[model samples]
Target: MGSILVVMENGTGGFVDSSKELIAKAKDIAKALGMSSVAIGFGSEAEKNLKGLSVDRVIAVSNPELTQYHPEAYEKALAQVLQKDQPFLTLVANTTMGMDLGAGLAARASLPLIAYCSQLSVEGQEVLATSSVFAGKLMAEIVVPESGAVISVMPGQWPQDTDRGDPPIDRMSLDLPSSMKILQLIEPEKGDVDITKAEILVSVGRGIDNPDNLPLAEELAEAIGGVLSCSRPVVDAGWLPKSRQVGKSGQTVKPKVYMAFGISGAPEHQQGMKDADLIIAVNTDENASMMDIAHYGSTVDMLDLMPALTERLRGE
Candidate 1:
């Protein structure tokens, strides 16, 4: 069996949480397959981040052209590393950069590509990867028969392994083409609150009905000393900003307690807050998808329950 290759990404401070999740998963897959795991880093900063991860080896691809992220440059550099290493399974985080890089590398190498994988395992000799489809309504398992396959693992699916010590880093020089140049990197506007750091989140969904009903959720959040967050629909409806949205496309939060109101529990939304210590979901429908992962489920009307729950918490 060939080695498992994890393509890591660096963020503002160091490695992104998704990259750490990939590294942990990659280590598990490598151990299961009786193969070593190797992490591929782009630059010096990435190398520094990769060192702290628990992997067999870290390959740092350094080049002046690799400073800023360019899709073509990343593809070319990763293609060279892949050709040389030829790992059995290449993993990348299912992030913005990972999505672009994974697709480009898969296309460039003509390898099988799997995206948004939440679960992975080895059944006999076949590599099975499970991902959600139809907006988290159905789960699809992909089987890769080829030796070299590229998989983009979703963020927040696997927990980060922080117990491991620093691994040895090997520097590789790559001759990148000067065709594509990044002119400027524009950052998104910052939101009022960073929901990712919130210890408690009172999240609402489309079931809230009207924008006027938002104050009820806010009152509940405040009553419990928690922050008010929402699903994607709430943000789309202009009831909440994008910063307060929790899902795969939004913020990934691992709060101590997550209370869901009127949320159907789509897979995209579940991926974000599923790791919370305590998940309590209240919806009209008992058979809703949100109930599937909730620690405690309530089949009560959220509109009626919110006020009462808030009042009870406030001892009013």
Candidate 2:
């Protein structure tokens, strides 16, 4: 059996959380298949990050063209690496860069592609990938071709690999094409806090009614010493920045306590917060989807509940 390959992505500090999840899953798959797990990362910081991950081999391609995300440059560099080291299965994160890179590589390399995977397993001679389709209402299991396959797994579905290791790095210097250059790396302005790292969150939704009523939720968050967060509708209405939004398109959070106010709980929104240790939902509609999955739910108007909760917490 060939090695299990985990294609990693570089982020602000090091490898992104999604990539870490893949590393853990890859290690498990490698153990099952009696094969070694190998990881490939780009840039010097990625090399530094890859060195600490618990994998059998770490392939680091440190080059200027590979530092930032360039579609052509990355594809070219990765293609060369793939040709040199043909792994049986390659795992990619279901993120923006990963999606593009995985699809492009599958097409260019003529490899079978399995995307939006929530679970992956090796059974006998076949590899199976389970994906959620129809906006996550249905599950589709696909059989990966045994020759070779590329898979993209959804983020937040698996536990992140945190074990540290000092793996030897195999450095590669590819003669990558210079067809494109990233002139300015414009990033979203950093928010007051990283919601993904917060332990407690007071999240508001469209049920808050007006933007002026946001103060109630903010006060409640302040009183509880939690960060103020919101659903997609709240961000779309300009009541909160996208930074504070929690949903499929936004950051996925696994806080110790997640308080949802007036959220109708669309499937997209639920995907982001379903993993919270404790979910407390308050909505006017008792049948709201959010209420069904919440640990504790109340059908009281959030407009009435926020201030009362805030005062009670402050008094205590």
Error of 1 at 26 (Å): 2.8
The best candidate in terms of TM-score: 1
| Model 2 ranges off by over 4 Å | 46-48, 162-170, 191-200, 206-227, 247-255, 262-275, 282-293, 298-316
**What shift in Å separates residue 188 of candidate 2 from its native position after superposition?**
3.1
Report, for every candidate in turn, its global Cα lDDT versus the true structure. 0.84, 0.84
CA RMSD of all predictions: 3.1, 4.1
List model 1 lDDT by residue over 1-316, tens digit each. Answer: 5789988787777777888888788888888878898888776576666666778888887664565677887898788878888888889988778888999999988798888788888877677999777766678988876666899887877778675757788888766677777888765334999888889999999999999999999999999999999999999988898989898778889999999999988877887898899999999888788888999999888999999999999999
Whole-model alpha-carbon lDDT for candidate 2: 0.84
Cα lDDT tens digits, model 2, 61-142, are 8885577777776777677777878787889988778889999988877898887788998898677899866645566999
